[model samples]
Target: MIKTIKHFTISSLLYGLLFTSCDLDRLPMEGPSTGNFPANEQEAILGLNGAYQSISTLDAASTPIWHVMDNITDVGYARPGNNYTSPITSSVTTDNALATKPWQYHYRTIARVHLVLDNLSNLETSMDEGSYLQLAAELRFVRAYCYSQLIELYGNVPLLRHAVGLDNADVPRTPKAEIQQFILDEMSEIAEHLPINQSAYGHVRASRIAAYMLKARVALYAKRYAVAAEAAKKGLEYAEGIHDLTSFNATIDVAGKDHRAGEPDVSNIFGHEGYANSAEWIWVAEYSIAAGNTHNRQYYGASRLGKGVCYWGPTQNFIDSFQALDGLPIDESPLYDAQRPFENRDPRLDLYCVRPASRFMGYQFQPQTEHRTVFNYWPVNNGSSSEPSSVTNTDATNAYRSFSGYLWRKHLDLNDFNSTSVSGESELNVGIFRLAELFLIYAEAKIEANELDGSVYSAINKIRQRAHMPPLTEGLTQQQLRSALRYERKIELANDGLRWYDLRRWGIATDVMNGYLYLNRAGNGWSTNTLQYIDENHNPVYNHNEATKHFTTQTVIYKENKDEYWPIPASEMDANKQLIQNPGY
Candidate 1:
């Protein structure tokens, strides 16, 4: 019943800005009525497309919105230069721009769907029921998605089922539990009508599996473990046939000036080009040079393979979360070497970050080293085995040249063209939903339900095997499996912008991120408090011969919140007297 026609024609429209005329202040004294729009199926498709447009705001490569999700978590650190320190370690307020923007954007998306939904009742011409159901399901799916995000971010939010007029629009907040049930029910009703597969790339139309996935994720967040487990299982029924953990290695040119093979695990799974219309993609935020953050994503967090702000970096705590290839933590495994911290870690860790001496984009990035004369190890009498680097502090703000010293490597465009800056036409894409995530969902839900069957082990191991890590120990207890699930999600889904939510869903944000996050700094020829590297007692001087001042810890404290939700935008509270702010705002 889902419409095969995809894509919106109304590209000019943006977050809640309806343009009546080209003139800024001038309105036509008399304009065509709303009745004139979408008289046929072709036009209705455009209206549906317009509803889907708001999703672009969620793309990390395009906007600053994702910074909220990435920075507020324990896994990542916000660059101090952009002044994102507040989101990371300060008290978040209702006036926070990150809190307000997502509210406006999601509602704007919801409102667009309301247009199609509201007009469906007034359609003058006859339309097929199958076609009508398909259109209706698509809108409902989008609406549910927006509400789901609102529920995750704000907790209790107004569920606007249909479009509202500009005047008389004060709506009260609905309890989150009620909204959660409503979404599950609504998706169940629409599942029979949606397509089994989306007809085109970047389209918002859901297949039955997408609906199940949404339900599974929502139920998991809702803590309906049994419901989540069953829904995830059903989702896998549709997923297993169409998508697999398998990936292909293609020799693609980097901006046609350099050549590199796709990363074995994740590189091929993401990005707009090369993988377009690939079966593994369940949902994505599609964009073009016409409308995308090709420049913005490159500007921040991306590697210096292109010019970037390096506005964010991962913490040493997150880096340590990766297990050795032998399926043991660095502390447990004999492979770990304190002198060379990044070596022999999980392969994905290197793929996802620009660590001390890792290679990427034809450059050996060393963020923790001092200037050229400085090597990480003592190279003279008591020297290090590590090689030296010309590029010290590779991941840092250009203004300050200081950072947490780790850079996120996922979704970065490393071609020669964007090697220093984006052309505003970068072809990177955002993955909204993928099969690998579903596997985790199923595994996590099963663990939560205390039902660690063979399927649970199979699901979790598929992702582990792809990353080329050893399989988990078989026949583990439920508690042990839960621990395994936590690590799997952390390493597998790092920097994909989901860890923040995971911290909340697992009810461990306070325990995991509350205290000081330790960042280890080590370099040769540096002075220390213990005078190990210092030769003088009163006037401290470095030996410059020993790897002294070896490693020091920097702390960033994350406060535990009374409630898991972010504050509702202060402006919304002021505008709507009936609206209540979330706890601890």
Candidate 2:
């Protein structure tokens, strides 16, 4: 087992409590202060672990914040509530927990990092030079990561380089560009302090390659395409033999007797097993029941029939985004049949989501009422003498099940199925950075820069080959290549917490989100002409008149300037007078 520095020890908890009394700017008046703590190498490591504990706090809800983030975007939907529905519909308030938590938690992490950095130099004489520098670099990476998330979500935020007392706590919001530059510069400076590969350390800690990938991502988000491509190239060079894509785990047939070669199963990559033995993962946030750091991932992602409430799921728009087997979109492909939609689509559609009539966990997952009972496939696999029997399909009958009529199977694990219950928590590690995402980043940055070449095609084809899809055709224009790149990112990275950022960065959220979000709880087929076309951004466009006749519709609105970024929390504004809220709040 890998010994990750993610344990929520007593000292880490106490350090977290020190910043709980106020917002990011204030320090604790009655707890362990930085002055008397982290006085040695052991305490320094403990303090660093405290900084890492903020990652667990991100799972403030039923699932990690990253998994829940896509629910508010165009691709996924959450259980209906103000917190989930209001953001996508442009009615969210400054006091909403979803909007406030990101601001609060990210700043709290930044403060904790500053606390450790402020006193880390005291033990330099006792520790080796390389160890001391590596410790500082790791802490800086954590701070830079927090700022990266903040600038993406909230735009401009207060940038504090060091720990501050109450007198100097209030600071004005810095321009997002400056902070982006600071992140780029800091990542460049600290990349050498970290190791190139941390496989011996369980791939949980930040490595030199991970820092370059972060730099590339930040630069791409800022539209610095050349810089992004260069950083990505460096990262890929370092990761040549160290990291690559992991093949999907084989899926068992319904009889539990045969394994299918065509079916794609990602349980080994995104599930608990991936944390232990996945080469594709570059940096991870590890969770362990043994260390008392975990979240209810399977509890939120599994279906009601599988002992989960099904709090989040994919939207109909997302389901239609997958291409036909021929690598052409459903609307343009001759292989597509509206009546047999699930048969000839990309394998990832089934790999990532559980639609009606699909086998999930141990039962046939039919979310429509027509299927009263589904065949149970677990008994035979578990060595029971009794044959498989029909069981109540609670997923179809439960009032609070998935609103979109689909459930996520991406990060869920079959090994945890028997253990899943209302009270069960999952220790599956969440990926922070992975090799597949890095490849997509390189391809996208190169495409945007109009630097298309064999390398770009190789980067994209590697991902497609892994998914059993055809590679991009030769002699395509830059516009067509952009669409292809967008398609890859939308499908390959769906529900991985990056769609909302992609929509805004691509300037298509307003166009795609203002319309109605479609659903098909009955799993009914549509007319051949129901889908108008696939848009340039790879979003499926539907004919409204024909769509509502067969599918359920939900209204969504996105304001041009306002919904692009969330409002600064009301508490932060009241606590710091210098903080100016984002525009149109």
Candidate 3:
């Protein structure tokens, strides 16, 4: 919530109260140090903003945050240069910075929320009682949102719904089942007091849709499929009026896809100009170019543009996760031709990554060319160091950049590469939730609940139609539908910081992230194939000896129950003696 802390007058006065870690044993008889603040409407509004500021404690483009969230799952692989082997291999210790960050930021936000809620009984405002109730509901929504993530990440975390002083801070960890119910109950109960819509673009506030979104996600995580289904249905009803999926259907002339996809599908949703004022974003975090956003995601996600560290590389497993146009994996689908791997694949694969031989930002990406710059054309406006960004592993570039054979294109701003200073100033908001996500949630929840009715099919088809993929067959068993739903959710939500959470919730992280995450090939099976060249649109031509070659990559071990929950930060337990670490931590 410190993202917008300047608007709040109490920031300077309550700095320690807002940022300091809480002690849980008891509350002193004396009152809160800053109890006198938040006495008026202006102060109340500022306090609410203070509570919301922690949402951006980790930026959309932050490497550390993304490394812990995405790399540990099946969808992402971080550059090995950072030396974060603990998280990469699923053996992270309690003292890891990754463990400390969510603990600090989430609880810090919860503390702010408690401050606002505790003052709710005393504030006098010009707005009606309904308006005050709406504000109260929003504060609770923020608190519930943080708790939802906390319980999932570190099960049995202390649930501090109210302001706690040093003397009263040492509370025992609440069971996840109970914490999950609390979140569901709070969101559903407060949802009625909230309006259907709030006119804000920067994700500065919450609405009824956010309440239902949280309810659906948390309920699903708790395996309360019925509640998840109902909440998703209600959320869909509210979202239908304001947002529609972006499309890239060149064959069909639809309202949203009235033009080319590069503009609407790719640009508007993730790029600079589009994120500046996008309709697809449901809940987002705002940043200022003047004050500077936290990180340059465009630089990290890129292979040729901007800073071009390309901090991550997509695993071959993730590449294969995408279904072919025939809605099947490459091994099963008839449309999939090994000679033409990129062709006949899902458009999302092309849109979300700079795939082999694909045209990108007015140039072609040819990783097999053996040139420093993989792209046929490089933007020279930005300062250069004689060699292209492709020449990584040198003095100016990182050795692990894009070593995984693919780069992320989903959350990056394509236009932020104008210059050194401007390139690092991408203010693209991180969408906390999106309309497409709600659709998938509703579809999956309904499927799991054995209610494969017309509505379920309709909801899924809307998402599929946007991606220009084929629909589900006429009849599929519950098990079959479950399979379909699983892949759909994975592909649609990849790299948006939801993959790890989704895998853990579905109990599939152990299966998916079990082994090698393919980055780039250098020896044994890959070198011989580089000699044969093909056109950008052509499939790779392998020699007779190299035809049976298999690529080499890195390995990761997901420790089943052990890795499902992160450890409580060592410092947190030191501060509160009553706290116990999660199992196997």
Candidate 4:
């Protein structure tokens, strides 16, 4: 007979309140003790709320640490005056303040989750078996999530399972392979007990599907192609049961009028409303300003909009990758008349970026006047105004006034009607994992496993079809298929902060990023390599015309290295002597 621990309503309420309030640092009245043991229970639910709270707060959007990583990568370029650092593209050191901060936060969250797991394992209560299993599953999910972050950023991290006291804080680093295995094992165990359907916790909480998706992601990162494919297939099974493809109009519509009418196909997985619980999303971090927590939208909003605190522009490499509307490469497509570059390009380009002189939400986006340019195609001053305002050797005749020539388009809520509105505060759930990503994962895994002629074609074809791209020709070699897969992933996941990681994992960052930089300089009458335009008066404009030089151009070679892992913060090392720095840091 299993003895059951009585459910304490008061205790549960208190825990709920603490999590709902988003405060985990507060000291409990009973100190850190797990209280009395129960007779037959193998786990306790107490302190699990703290672990869940950590997940919600550590989201990349809301946390400055995650944003720091996003800004430093090639997917987005920081403004000239911005003080941001990224370990992926630049050499980040222990002395670098931003590089060291994320290490501390991640470790702190890990410590809390470890405490919950420790207490749960020791409990002897005959508590609700279902509840105990659910709590244990959630704890494992979060622990695996923390390790995933650590593995991606630091390469190897200490895989501490027990809650350590101050005296036992010094723990040695675990090997990267071992750490990844540990995470996979934990997620696999959790998946067995996690619920498959939506419940009281909502879509923001981890379900069995989320665990499987995470397993797939971690396996792919570790280059375990077979395991990745299996995990992705499992996740897709659940994802397919839930979401259908949203229509192109709904995906690109700023008004969201179709979405508001309860039209399922009109909502994206990332929209603020309508699709929060849609089948597309396997996991999301929920946010509401009324809850005293907000998602990170300030990074991309207009400066006139109160939250536009950071301006990380897009790169020329990204802009050039978008295929023409007819599915031909920009360089290959005859419709790609260099003079009018924006016309007839992939629809995603217009949906994902706000280019200079482009219309978004009925307002003209003039980069020179507002410093809201989309990509880094113009000259950027390094701390001083002494550098030439125009890019050297590039025609100043077609220069735009802004330093970065592109603005972020994804996740920006245009339907809010107010230019100054903070779209980040909306109740929309921020998707951490989605089905479309799973499809890409399956496609990549199959390609890597030398199964390109098998199911890989179907998976890749689905994504290409959505992008309106033609099917990849049959009989291509593995290397050719790999190239195609890489291109597909880039365009499909552009502006979603996946490019930097993908490039690093594929070991192609240097080759892809090292090249001449160019921007569409048509606005200022400067010819970007001899393209011409005309004014409303029908006057033929030369590359030197005022309209031609309005576009800006900035180009520089990027230095990259295998020292891709960020250095564990010196502060953490000082506190935990067992933590080792990654190689070449």
Candidate 5:
């Protein structure tokens, strides 16, 4: 018996309340004593709620930390700041907020998990066996999740099984493999006890499928291909009708009459309505303005014209990674036109990203300085009778406009446009897992294990079809299928916080990250001849000799051993004398 709890009704929206505070200065365990506080079922639920809240802390920008993570990777760029720059430049110090917050917050969650886990036996008499098992399983799932993120970001971390007092706070770092095995075993042990769908609990909590999916994802990250394949296959089989990709074909306000790109709006899936309606989300970190548990994603992610400062956007390298309309790289496909680049490109380019000459947030989103004013179609009285009128093109003329000349449109909801401000109070929920990602995980795991089959192609094609891209041809070589899978993950999972991990796990982080990150600050188009070739990973390689003269570029630095894992924070190393630092830190 791990721990026991008393009976109480768990709220459907458990994490909407203020976060439980614990003393975490010297170690994760120095907090309110977990022994007697959670004497009943409601306290246990509150303790568990704290654990979930710990993982979803927002940054100084009030953006979800997960959404802000990818901005420092090769796929995206962010406004100039030490928090964003240090990681990309590989100059991160142990005290850097970005590096330290995860270390601190995850351990804080582990602390909260231990609060209930250490004393569940107390309620074993009052709670039924099934209820007890489910409660313990959910607690363990959160602990496993915290460790999964820890091992990926920090390599080896302290594996605290229970809360410790200040006197016994010091603990040595565990081996990465040992912690990974713990996560796999914990997830496997708890999966049978969890429900397949947590819809009754607002879908924010872990379910049976979410457990297996987490297991699969951890196994895949650890390169245990067989284990990953088995777990992912089990999860997919369990998810048959309960979960599937949300369609974008619905009539959404993403496009206007003048827009040339086909309307493939994803706002219905990534916006407020998605959390309320879409079944694609497996696990979500829920937030609400009315509930006072919200973030400023709309304010940070929206463009200047949309009332945001444009803190982050995709890099030109990422923009060029989108395949042409014919399902081929732009360098190889004749359908690509340099002059009219937006046309005949992947609809995702227009759907997921806001580039020049496109309509976004009821405004023409041209970033070139020549356009001091652009057309706004937003109705005067917020009615349907409004006419298009010229408005100041802050996206083009503002000094603090988008640096990469593009804005992420994937999670930005037009419905939130009117409320976009510096308050950081947007109610959009960020997705942690989805059916499409599970399909990609299963496909990649099978391909890596040399287990070629129809299932692999079907998994990959399902995601492509949703994006309106052509289905993959039958009988592609293992290497070719690998490329196809990589393409989908890069494009489909762009700003969802997986690219940094994907680059490192695939052993291509060094090659892709240790070069110039090209930018088109003016939203200017370049010649097709500037494209040198597409790499094995489907990343576009450009002729820097000519590109340097036309586009502004940022230098990226990534050392081999040193950059693989973020350094154990200097504060942690000092706080725990038994802990040793990672390489080159």
Candidate 6:
């Protein structure tokens, strides 16, 4: 004889309520309404789908944003050779148009999960136990992933667990350390519930192994060396017997497409065609051109080589780090010639970048060829507010102008070489997490925890051995081992957007960034005339030289500070009044 409330929508009511309320009705009850779900079961499933959908959005793993984040560290640079200008710096810090996308997207996702968890208690059927567990686990994983991204981009974000309607939007910031711990705890729990084989759910969904991999990555960023090592080992174990390394040539092919079928190959590691489900990938952000959803290849790859978007160059320091084919450092290589810098470096350098004098797409690159500099444009003016004119023709005179002195090749589809069409329809799944990264993570953790013996060498040697390079010599000290680990990471993960974060976590960004900024200018012989040239109209034209004078030797230096963390977006600050800002914003 419970009192019935007609005003409550059937969708909002629990399964028990629906059964009891409609028991007297002779006719069959309609399924849950469009606005509501049967109870905890349906809603919970919806919640999990919502979380996965959030990941599918471009912003989560957008290549353009990833490029921006990666280039700021030691390995990459923005246009006008030796210039310090790029759109990323302008937008990422201050209130700019592009910054809003990442800030908004991440919070929107977190909010969806919060709503799901808040209403979990309303689920009615005991029969829904399996569904509930799976939903809860997936939601927790998504929440942890989002929070980690937020913390990395903007430190000290408000950790919201409950759904807050518009009226109560203002929540205070949580301590970074607390947030980190919470994420670790949530991921650890979710890992236990997730399935080892996600074949039923497909590669797009997070599985038990993905959770473990994420846990290791989070632990590493938190600087918990022992925990990081343990978690990384678990992730490695889960991935073991799952994927075998593809041959060098095959890996190169997978770099071109984003479909997976048949046995795993090297290209499979990269989400290329016939390789999306390869064992190498621990987590991936899926994209479909048919869905009208794609990454911003036009921004990263369009330059003079293709459509003339912007080409961010690589630093000399990065180039120098590549070992010669014989496993010798470039500086130490007998084949090394300072004048002919591009010759005899690691094969990866050639594979990853389109440098001067390199052959690409059946053409030997000349400093003055259409094909040579086609993909080398930078978004910002190297010196001033004036924008550079786009190169309409691929003639020799415009060839070097199109070159940023470097080209990005990783995660790009070379087959899609038409410069006139500037959309990223080419199918190449952007991998968010992969096994190669985990291997380096294990190596780093072992070294940090003083476990760098044969096991550590073995882990490091695997990556080196794959690159067809020699293994590390035995009996090295901790410092030497550390150097070797760092070098391995740089070569393997370069242009994959991990270097900047690696430098920050390793506490070397300030020194390395400052040193490179100095050397690029010095080596380029920056002067009034250095960056200037005559215009096509035969008029004397000035480049970024005037603005270059503003940056003294001192302007290039940065102190590694707590402020290394980016500021929380202003919109978030306003929405969550309770949220605290990081210090020195």
lDDT values of the candidates? Answer: 0.61, 0.81, 0.64, 0.56, 0.81, 0.56
* Per-model TM-score on C-alpha atoms: 0.82, 0.94, 0.84, 0.77, 0.94, 0.76
Which tens-of-lDDT digit does each residue in 123-218 have in candidate 2?
889999999999999999998998999999999888888876667768889999999999999999999999999887667678999999999999
Q: Rank the models by TM-score, top first.
A: 5, 2, 3, 1, 4, 6
Worst 10 contiguous positions by lDDT, candidate 1? 533-542
TM-score (C-alpha, index-matched) for candidate 6: 0.76
> Cα lDDT of model 2 overall?
0.81
Compose the digit string of candidate 6's lDDT tens values, residues 1-585: 111111112332332232334211111111112223325476566555655555545342235455555565556665432223422232234353344455566666676566566566566355366656666787788878888887776777777776555555566677778999998888887787787656454455677878887888888889888888888888778777874454365444322121121111233344254244456666665554443445665445533435444455565445556766676664346775655555565666766765544433323333433332332222221343233234333423443333234555565554444422444454355666777788888888888888876878988888787766788989988887888888888878876777767767777655554532421322222343322332221112224345245222212344455436655656556645676765555
- Report the C-alpha lDDT of model 1 over 1-585, residue by residue, as the tens digit: 111122433343432244333121121111123445556676667667666655665543344354336655667776552235555554667776666667777876776676567777555347788888888888899889889989988888987876555343578899999999999998889987887777364534567788889999999889898888888888789776676664433322111111122222235555433245456667665544443323366456654433565666776567666766677776556775555555566777766665655444444444543433222221221344344334344433244332556667666545422334654444355666778788999998889888878999998988887776788888899888988888878777777678878877776766665545534333222222222211111111223233223433434445555347778888777766778888666
Off by over 4 Å in 5: 1-21, 24-29, 58-60, 250-264, 384-386
User: What are the per-model numbers of colliding residue pairs?
Assistant: 5, 0, 16, 40, 5, 32
For all predictions, the C-alpha RMSD in Å is 8.8, 3.0, 6.7, 10.6, 4.3, 12.5
Q: Once superposed on the true structure, which residue ranges of model 3 sit more than 4 Å away at CA?
A: 1-32, 59-68, 81-84, 124-127, 249-265, 291-293, 359-363, 372-398, 419-423, 521-550
Candidate 6: segments with Cα more than 4 A from true spot = 1-47, 56-64, 79-92, 97-100, 121-128, 199-202, 250-268, 274-277, 361-363, 369-403, 418-420, 423-427, 515-559
Estimate the lDDT of model 4: 0.56
TM-score, structure 1 vs. true = 0.82
Tens-digit lDDT track of model 5 for 99-190: 88888878877877887889987888878888788888999999999899999999988888888777788988899899989999998899
All candidates in order of lDDT, best leading? 2, 5, 3, 1, 4, 6
